[model samples]
Target: MKRSTKITMVVSAAVVTGLLVLALPAMIGATTWVTGVFGAGSGSPAATEPPNPTADPASDDGLVDLGDGISVPAGGPGECTSTAHISTMSTRTDDSGPYYSKLIGDLVDRGPSELASGQALTDEAGGVYAYEVAAGDSAIAIGERFCIDYITVQSHNHVRAGMIHAGNILYLRPDPTLPWVSPYEPFDVQPGEQTGPYYDAIDFMRNAVVAQDLAEAQRVWAGLGPHIHPDARTIATRALEAGDWELLRQMFP
Candidate 1:
C-alpha cells in the first residue's frame, strides 16, 4: 500500500478507539455518563459519606463556648434504657383512702420484676425526678416538687379531680423550661424567645413522653439544646445534678 493511504488508515483507527472509550461507560450502565475527563465535576471526599448521628460527648475540640461555661458538645442524653414500660395497677394494688401512703408503701415493697418507674419515666420522657412519692402528694404538689407547672403535670398525665391512687405510674418534670431554651428545629423561635411554635413543639414532646415514644422524645430533646437561658440555668443545674439526662439533653447554651 501507498505511504499516504497507510497513514490515513492509522488515523481513522485512533479516532474510533477514542470514541469507543467515551461510549463504554454509558453502554455498561443505563444512566447517562457525563463526568468530566480526569477529576472534573467530581465530588469531594467529604460528600461521599453520611454525617454521623451519634457522637462522643467527651470530644470538644471544635465546640463554641456560649459563655457562663456553657458550650456546644456539652453532651446529650446519657445511656438509653433497654425497654420502655409503664406500671399498671395489679389486683393487690391498694385502693383504700390515703392512696399516696399506699403508693409509697408499694414502692418500698416493690417486687423483683426489676421495676423502677421513676427511672423509666426519666428515660422515656425526662419527666419526674424522685424515686419515691410523699403521703400527701397530689398531681399539683408533685409538679411543684419537680419545679414544673402544676397545670403541665395535670394536663400531661390526664389526671382527674386531682385524685391519687396507689401503684399509679406518674411522669415527673423536675426542671424548669426557662433555663434550657432550645433552638431545636421543631421549636422555631429566636434563641431567647418563647412563641407559639415553641409551645407547640413542647406540647408535641410532652405528648410523646406521655405516649412512651422513647425515640421521638430523644430526638426533640436533642434539637432543643441551644436556647437555654442563663436565668434558668440553676434549675437546669439542679436537674442535671440529679441525673435528669433526658431533659438535660434538650437545653442549648
Candidate 2:
C-alpha cells in the first residue's frame, strides 16, 4: 500500500511541473504586453512619441505680415493713454470740391482760435500725443489742429480718406528719431488700376522706413523694381539708402 501511494504522489508532482512549464510562456507574454502599454521594460514595443510642433519662421524674426506687401514688427506700440480735454463740434465740409482740394481748403478756412483750440493730451517727452476725434472732425482739420500735415495724420492713424469717425483715438507726433510703431490697424490700400502698384509699394516702403528697417525697405523697393517707374525707383532707392522716412511718406499720393 505504501509503495503504491508513493508512486501516485510522484505522478501527481510531475503533472504539476508540466502544467507550470506550459503556463510560463503565456505569463511572460502577458507581462510583456503590460510593459509595452505602460512604456516600460526592455524588448517591449517602442512607444511612439508625439512629434513636436514647428514655429512660424516669420514669428521667430519678430515680423508680422499685414498683407499687400506690408509687414511690421510682431508686437506693435505700447498702450497709450491721455487725459487732455477734447473739443467737439458739428462742422462738415462741402463735398463739391475734390477731396484733396476740400482737405486743404478746410485747413485754410479755420481761424487761429479754432486751430489753437484743437488740443491733445501729450506724453511726458512731448514726442507723442493722444487726440480724440470730435463730432464733424476731418483728417485735415485734425491735422491742422495738431500742427501736422493731413497726410501724416492719415498715414499715422491708418485712416482712410474721409473715414474719421467721432470718438476715434488718434496718436499723433510720433518721434521720428524713434522706431515707428503704430497702435492702429494696418492700412489696406489696393493698387489703383491707373496707378499700378505704386501706392502699395510706397506704403510698404513707408512702413519699413518708419520701423527703421533699411534691409526690409530695400527688399520692398527691389520687389517693386519692375512695376514702378525708373525715376521713382531711383528716388526710392536713394531715399531708402539715406534712411529717409519722411521722403517715403511724402511719396504717397
Candidate 3:
C-alpha cells in the first residue's frame, strides 16, 4: 500500500472513531459534508496534522483501485469490508444481534448493502488523488513522480516542514481543468448510458458486502467473470467517498 493511502486508512479509522465517539448521530452529517470541495464546493485546508509514522502496515494490507489512477489501502477480510467473505468481518457484531434482514428489501435485484453502500467519489476539487511516500522520498522526488512541482507538492500536501518519510500520505490536488466523475452519477460515459453498475460490477460487489451476504456477493462475481478486476473491488475507498454515501457510520458504526 502507498503511504498516502495508508494515511487515509489510518485517518479514516481515527476520524470515524472520533465521529462515532464525539458526534454519534451527527456523524452522518459531518462526514457527508466534510469535503464539498471535491463534490460541489471549495474545500479549505484545516489545521490538521498528518498520520502518525509509528504504525506499521497490516500484513494483509493491499490497494483497492478507485479508477482514475487513484488507489486506497485496503485490508483482507478482517481489515476491509470490501470483499464478499463474511469470515473476514471483525468479531464485532451488533449487540442487538446479527443483522439478518435482506441486504435490500425484496430486491433479489440487489443486496441491502449494495443499496446502502451508496454513491462514489466522482465529486471534489475537480477530482483528487492521494500519493504515498516511499522510504528515502523527498518533496522534489514526489513532485517529479507525479509531474507536479515541488512547491505545489509541499503546499497541496500541507508539508510545512520536516523530511518526507516512508508511510507519509499526501493528498494531491487535481488540476481543475481535468474532467472527473461523480459518485452519484458514475454512468455518464455517454449521453444515455446506465450500464455502469451492471458493466463495472459495482452493484454486484456493493450489495454483497453491505448486506454481509458473502454468498450472494460471491455469486454475483461468478457471473461478472472477466469484467471484474482480479482484486474484485470495493465501492467505498476514501473518506469523502464513504461520507457521500453514509457508508461509514452505517457499515462500521
What is the full ranking by TM-score, best candidate first? 2, 3, 1
Best by TM-score: 2
Residue-level lDDT tens digits of model 2 in 1-253? 2212221232223132221211111111111222222345422112122122223345564554433222234444211121111111111232111111101111111222332333343332222234556666676556554343555455445455547666555545332211122212112213433443554665676566667787887788676655543444455566566655544443421
TM-score of each: 0.23, 0.30, 0.24
Best by lDDT: 2
Runs with alpha carbons beyond 4 Å of true place in candidate 3: 1-32, 35-128, 174-253
Please report, as a residue range, the 10-residue window in candidate 2 with the lowest summed lDDT.
97-106
For each candidate in the order shown, give its overall lDDT on alpha carbons.
Answer: 0.30, 0.37, 0.30
Error of 3 at 18 (Å): 36
Per-residue lDDT of 192 in model 3 = 65
User: What are the per-residue Cα lDDT tens digits for candidate 3 across 90-163?
Assistant: 11232111111001000010101211221112223223233445556665544433333344334323343535
What lDDT, from 0 to 1, does candidate 3 have?
0.30
